[model samples]
Target: MQTKLRSRTITKPRSHHGKPAQSLVARRLPAKRPPTHPGEMLLEEFLKPLGISQSAFAVRLGISFPRLNEIIRGKRRVTPDTALRLAHVLGMSADFWLGLQQDWDLWHALRSKQAAAIARLEPLRHVS
Candidate 1:
């Protein structure tokens, strides 16, 4: 999914040092689309391009074919163990795979009902 992000300046409360705090936040307000699942990315970008079958890749990764298939279908999450295996087999960093999964999971969580309640929460101020 393509998302067009625009930057907005946010001013935060001054710290003990009395310096004006400002940050440029690139908010994705227009597009609420969830991030691409790592499994889908793996299937499209790596498996298909490299002409590797799911079963063969699973064997190489030392995982069950069904587990890999579930991941490809977006029914399973890519755990740290799986991420490390993928990194070792595909020559990509484990962080790359885990980052994708984290993004996907966070996007969904932020849209959940629990997130609505969390959004109404106010941060506690320190009296230092």
Candidate 2:
């Protein structure tokens, strides 16, 4: 009678071809939201620290009181010219105002782009 040999069993298996495995890390992308204008933030900071009335600040800034109020209320936008005027009256740098305006502009631009892209997508329809 011939003796039969049994194959050896391996406890730990390496790579298919015995090569080292590479490591990879996956990261989640940031979520997007409706962009906001920064005029509100700048106006809030200007008003909050001094505890001054909006009307008074507007007068001092040479801007219409109603317009200033609108800007504060987020109904009106902060234009570069308006920001410069505000900065001059508030003893802030023009650069600071410009930065805020720039941020607001970029945000609105992105928001518009997003809206356009969404408009191009197919709308959901209900089935009868």
Please give the lDDT score for candidate 1: 0.76
The sequence of per-residue lDDT tens digits that candidate 1 reaches over residues 1-128 is 23233554323323234653222123332235878899999999999999999999999999999999999999999999999999999888999898888878766765667865655556678989
lDDT tens per residue, model 2, 10-128: 22212235643221111111126433445567556667777888888888888888988887777777777787887678677777666655655554553464644543446568999
C-alpha RMSD by candidate, in order: 7.8, 20.5
Q: Tell me the TM-score of each prediction against the true structure.
A: 0.75, 0.54
* Cα displacement (Å) at residue 105, model 1: 0.7
Regions more than 4 Å wrong, model 2: 1-36, 113-128
- For model 1, the superposed segments whose C-alpha errors exceed 4 Å read 1-30
Predicted model with the maximum TM-score? 1
Pairs clashing within candidate 1: none
